[model samples]
Target chain A: MRAAYRPGPDAGVTVSDDGMSVYVARLPGGPLLVLDGAAALIWAEATTAPATGWVARVAELVGQPEDAITADVRAFVADLSARELLVPLGGDADPPTRA
Target chain B: MATQEATGAPSAGATVPLEVRIGFAHASVQWIADRCGADLLHVKGAALDPTLVPGRGYSDADVLARPAHVRRLLDELPRHGWELINTFVYGSSFEHSATLRHQDFGLLDLHRIYPGTGPTPERAFDTLWSQRTTKVLGGIDCPVPSHDAQAVVLLLHAARGGSDAKAANDVEWLWTSADDAARDRVLDWVGRLDAGLAFSVITGTLDEHRDDPAYDLWRVAARGGTRMEEWRARVRAARGLRAKLTVASRSVLVNVEHLTIVRGRPVSRAEIVAEFFGRPARGLREQVSRLARRSRR
Candidate 1:
């Protein structure tokens, strides 16, 4: 699954070693934070799925209530998107820092 | 590989040093304050830190403002010739400047709110913000915050960032500079605000890493050195465990005080280092020897 990681300047998306989880940091603050294990798994799927209905897909895999999982996934993307961390796959946003 | 030699843990027996990086920092900040036309407050422990490290306290400078002025300062960064770094999420909010380097004087820090910012039981702003309590530096008049205020902030900075040897000196200066009444006021304020949290952290460091060479460095007076690997480990571990908690816990606090009361004898750097690493470096060889269970992850 795709997730954005800013190791230095540019943001790149890649599947995590664990394969299930993804890590993302937004701007306004360069390094927001880190989360591991299951949460990372969900995050990776949401950021990378390349479909409008990825939220529903994520719910099925994580084995949680569908509506709750969908809402949470949406909220996570909204935050990263608001912080300008992620773009809508093909489109871009504000000036990316040096990267 | 971590040792007292690398971390530059201040020796406990050396009385105090005469110069500190904080001195230049203070000077540079003062330069900024005068330029901004903001009222400057006397930062108590910075002067005393020099006594311990010979040149450490020179790096500190502080000023107080009504909460509203901070917004104006942020908006005017470009005009003032400073770049706005991230607004700090802990203690009181402050900004960082990438440009204010003084020639060998020290880095300057301009503060808006004192960490844990509040007047203590024995002090009010009037007493500390007095006209007479200032040291004339580049020729501008400034008021000093009470010693108690300075001490408390120092402790929080050490706990917040954990590498400020400067803050540790401020803890020691509670005894060196202020009277017993002021010290009690600081301790009382600390207890009132977050005794459980502070005690948990301070004692946690003390219990786990007190015997490492880093701890030993502060126990004896010796010239200090940088322990980059050890420092990095502490930063990584502290961030791993406390990173999320740091922003959330400090969300509601008023201005951050950057100093604290210097109580009795100072805790050793080895202790601070050990606490940061979650174990004493000195005993790692032995601890590694006792791999009773080869549990694989």
Candidate 2:
């Protein structure tokens, strides 16, 4: 099972009301990052729960086969994790309860 | 800190929106204040509760720090890319807020006092802080004055806003058309904050406060005044012999920081000398014209 993700402790995130863009910044200072297009789609799915098939959800949103986009999505998530803007929840940590 | 600029954009050439930048500015300051253990209330601009006036636009972020915490916040702001462009003493007639600029977040006004409030800053902060609530800005839960207190603060801002269309519009929506209960709540805050002197401008009872020390300050602010009148009013409003002297002295000095911004670079000493001499002549011209107009009337 893949680890779920959540915004990092210092991350300040705002998704536009239209859901077309996600603005993220590191607090105490910033170089604000705007994520849109496929990046926005990936962020939306990665932070939502049932982390099991999160990459597949991204693929579904972009209307591409899961296998084709899986490697790229992982790379993007890793980049965000390295920047400390997103954190991978431990396997034992509770998946956010769905509404 | 993950605050470093991203070297690559996921999508090419996507510029951050102005409001988004402002939101990040709020988040940046809140983070700084938290680290410094300072108390601040995000007010006006982006922090304002949107329901108060729908579609009201704002260009920058404004935050009010507890009076005692202001110096500490100022000391810490620069470490986070918040450059102090204008100190409070030169900020305005009230000397209330310092202007800071950030590389990614545009402009911010860090207020030590929310002009028109107070018999004193400490008491005024306590009154507002006691009823504070939180609002999310830049995805961080930020403290803000309560709904009713916000109404009072907004009205006070409009009261000194002179003939600014936006200020008048704020008054029309937040005061003129507000129901009696809303008015009562705002009045209660005004009394608690001891903001009656300035609030009188909104009530159109400004002439009644002629004897007040700060009366000319508010009068000049609300009705507009020539540069000479403004300095005279500032001198009159300053509390003590020392403070009045300070205001009077500053009225004659050139603001180097403002000059730098206007010129978009560090100014030369020669330029400073030129402006120093030029300002008094300009102030005198304005004063003379105003006097002539008054006599003609």
Candidate 3:
């Protein structure tokens, strides 16, 4: 299984004024993805800490139940991976499930 | 950390960061202008308000000065090591502005009037100067156009350049960042400049109009001329046999300096001549077809 997920090499991230995470690609006139507060926290943590426990950590930080957010987190990660905003570690695998 | 190169020398292959070079250029130009008692208004590029669009990259610095002060600055700039590269005179107010080069600074475009094709350059300059705001750049007080004025200039520039991406981005930034009052002010300036057509196209306001006479005027404006005005310009451009020949020759030969800048290197005269004649022809056929279609209407 993959150890973690990380932002793509071309992804340039900046924090918006309202605490959203804005991700821009290296290419000129590329798409801009603005991640909301909850997703921003997840991305902030995922970029630094291991992705293994990010689900529980994000759930705790957002004051949501781990089960309540499990599907949404997985979906968000999958969508990001599909868009090359997030890349899985150790090649490819299913989106990480809550540890 | 980059030391300024010898005054008036060419950078050639220097590795100085662009932003650092721009800062140096702004400071150097400001210092020299102050010494000559010339007021300099920094426009475009790094002069953009960072709070609206941060981390924007700029290749050159553009500054506007009074027409009378331009000659004095031009004569004195070389003494301080700024090399005068070119002076292109398109018309009275439609000049190319001066292109200056320095070893420490990358490229500087000094204008006596705003370069965009819009309302009269003198009027634009007076309005912008009246509303100019001072911003400190590289420890030098630089005058910048107000947001409303900047928006109008950027829109006109984008329209003239066939809607370039960077120009569009800057205009969009200004549009989104402006408050209702600022937006209204920009619209008023656009109308005054006869750039309402360009503005409508840029902001997609044209889409809401249906067979409107105003829309027709905007379309004509977007093309940079109406049919009668274009014909008059052609007549003016070909006033005499020598002028006609000059225009004809220019159509086939690229200016060596222009070729050099476009190619990003020193180009030989022969290369320029070859590129001029060998360059792909423009869409003259398509243009004629469009003209014919318009005539039929």
Residues A1-99, candidate 2, lDDT per residue (tens digit)?
554789999999989988878888988687677787788877888888777777767778899987777667767777888879899886522223223
Q: Taking the tens digit of each residue's C-alpha lDDT, what string does model 1 give over A1-99?
A: 433322222222223455642333221112322334555655555455344455555667777666665545555555555555455553221112221
Tens-place lDDT digits, model 2, residues B1-297: 122243245332236778888888889999889889999999988889889988889999999999999989999999888899998988899999999998778899999999999989988999999999998989888999999899889899998899999899889888899999988888999999999999999999999999999999999999999888889999999989999999999999999988999999999999999999999999999889999999999
Tell me the spans in candidate 1 whose CA falls farther than 4 Å from its real position: A1-99, B1-37, B40-55, B58-65, B89-106, B117-132, B161-183, B188-297
lDDT of 3 by residue, A1-99 (tens): 334676675444444445554332321112334455677776665554454666777789889887788778777777777767677774323334556
Encode model 3's per-residue lDDT on B1-297: one tens digit a residue: 111222323442232346545655666677778778987788777676776445667898888886668888888788766776666542211344778887656578898866442455566667678888987554357788886676677665555444456756766666766688878887888766656555666676764653543344344434454333433333343447786565445444455666666687899878966775554333344456678988999
True contacts kept of 1: 0.00
lDDT of 1 by residue, B191-282 (tens): 65433333233334433545332232221112222333333323332334475355334332222122111222345656444444543343
- The best-first sequence of candidates by DockQ reads 2, 3, 1
lDDT of 3 at B210: 35
Instruction: Evaluate every candidate with DockQ and list the scores.
Output: 0.01, 0.43, 0.01
Task: Tell me how far the alpha carbon of residue B205 in candidate 2 is from the true structure, in angstroms, after superposition.
Answer: 0.6
Pick out the ten consecutive residues of candidate 1 chain B with the lowest summed lDDT: B1-10
lDDT ranking, best first: 2, 3, 1
Clashing pairs in 2: none
lDDT of each: 0.39, 0.86, 0.61
How does model 3 score by TM-score? 0.54
**True-structure lDDT of candidate 1:** 0.39
True interface contacts reproduced by each model, as a fraction?
Answer: 0.00, 0.60, 0.00
